[model samples]
Target: MASNPPAPEAPYAPVQPPTDTFGYGGYRTDEGPWEEWNPTAESIRPVRGKHRVAKQRGGGFARSSTVLGVGVIAAVSAGGMASANTGKAPVSISMPDLPGVGSLISDDKPAPEAASALASFGSEAAVAVDADADADQSVADAGEALRSRIMAQAESQKTQVEVKAAAAAAKAKADAVVKAEKEAEAKAAAAKKKAAEEAAAKVEAARLAELAKQYTLPTSSYTITSTFGQAGSLWSSGYHTGLDFAAPTGTLIKAVHSGTVTEAGWAGAYGYRTILTLDDGTELWFCHQSSISVSVGQKVATGDVIGRVGATGNVTGAHLHLEVHANGNAEGIDPAAWLRSKGLNP
Candidate 1:
């Protein structure tokens, strides 16, 4: 772009001052004449690019340029006066004092004193802000620490509870195992004892069966008229002392076991009697016989005919009275029980 040349300086020309309405000149006092001036484009032109503001340093309003620094100080002074009028504390601002600038703002205080007061006020504000920041940081740190401590304590308590629960569960399981083992042992012992008892009973039954083949009844086809220990007035003793087998007269009587005939003779109440003594000294007595077949001291076998059934010598009927005396005792035992001991039913 082409630049235009600067306009020449206008000539100094003078004009008469104007009157209000009647062409009368305005009154002039002091020792000077009234002069007239007319504004032109060149006289009222705005200056450009002549004064440049220096860049500010350290974010402060103070500047190296005297013209710019004076404007900033004037604005701060106006703002302070406005705050004071509004009943609020005046804001303090720090700035470098420009030479001859303080005379334009405040004539009462020197520029250095005003600059010092502003710097002191700014320092105090900075200190207060730093203190507040430090206090907030401390509060934040304390809160974080407390939260961490609370979390740790809660975690520890939870861990302890979990451990205790696990321990209790383990103990219950162990106790259950012990109880089950004890119950199993008891069942096994009971089964063993039952098996042993059954075996013993089987052995006893087999022994009794073998003894059945060795013994026999004394007589056949005969009815038992009376048993041992029968209470009656027909006998001399208070109770019947023998087992009576009733049959027709002359019915043969057999020996109960292998024994020697100890005696065969007529007694007071026994018509014909025979006594058999075994090797073990167990005596068998046969009374009320019609005839005696075995002689005295005769070794007779089991099932041999020893006497005959007869009703004689205080007998109620034809019957054979049999008695058993162990070890040759005079008192006889129950003949039926003695026969059962030898594995005979009667």
Candidate 2:
């Protein structure tokens, strides 16, 4: 039958497993690594239709593996870069409040590109903090300037008030001085008035004293025959009640002191009489006249004629009777003593 296949070649040479002898493990040659064995169409038969076709055409499991590996590496690199950029916390910053910043930050509305550029460069909280810091600094500087101005104004006002107070105090002191001076002037005027009154009183006293010195008795300088207090009865009643002057009748009579003659008329027991009264309280009576020459209330001087010497009715031998009374009372004292009391010699 086809020569019977050359006697079947030793029972198909007893098929054996492949072995590795070189370090490449591609072939089992003992001297060195050999080329890896690849089967050709001339050596092997083709596989079944679709599975074999998929291997020769391009898109296979190997291409799918290469694409999946590249994608994995790219994703890993992107994630690592983002982590590096995001890890550092922002540096600390101080700021003042910005206009509309709080609204822009707290609300969901987005700002314009100009605004958002500044806004997004920092965190929303960081934006608020920067704006607030700048605003706070500006406000503090403005406040300091305003405070300085206010303090300066207050100091100026205080100085003005002090000046006004000083002026007022000076005015008050001047007014007080003027008032004191006026009071002193008034006191001086009162003192002068009082001194004038006292001086006038002294002058009046001196005038009254001088008038009493120059009066004498109204007779021929008669000697004392019967004094004012001789207590013996000579003719009538109980006592010699009249001062007797043993003078001739019709002797010219004179006034004793400057006075007014109250009466020059007839009397029953003392015939004719003249009554005279002087200022400052002294009374004189010339009794037993030969004739009457004066009437009531006739003014007379120290040496003027009032009436003649009298020796009528109850008189002995043409003698004159004289009487002196104090304050219209008939009480008697020594006539010579009373005349001396008036600074007059009888």
Task: Tell me the TM-score of each prediction against the true structure.
Answer: 0.49, 0.37
Q: Which consecutive 10 residues in model 2 have the weakest lDDT in total?
A: 14-23
For model 2, the superposed segments whose C-alpha errors exceed 4 Å read: 1-213
lDDT of 2 at 19: 42
Clashes of 1: 0
TM-score of 1: 0.49
Best by TM-score: 1
lDDT of 1 by residue, 1-346 (tens): 9899999977432233334312235645442322332333454355478675544434233324334545655455445444544545655555555544454355355567555644554565566567678889999999999999999999999999999999999999999999999999999999999999899878866765676665567787899889999998988898899998888998888888888999998987977889999989999989988989989989988788998888877797898899999998999999999887666776
lDDT to native, each model: 0.74, 0.63
Give the Å error, residue 150, model 1. 10
In model 1, the Cα lDDT at residue 287 comes to 91
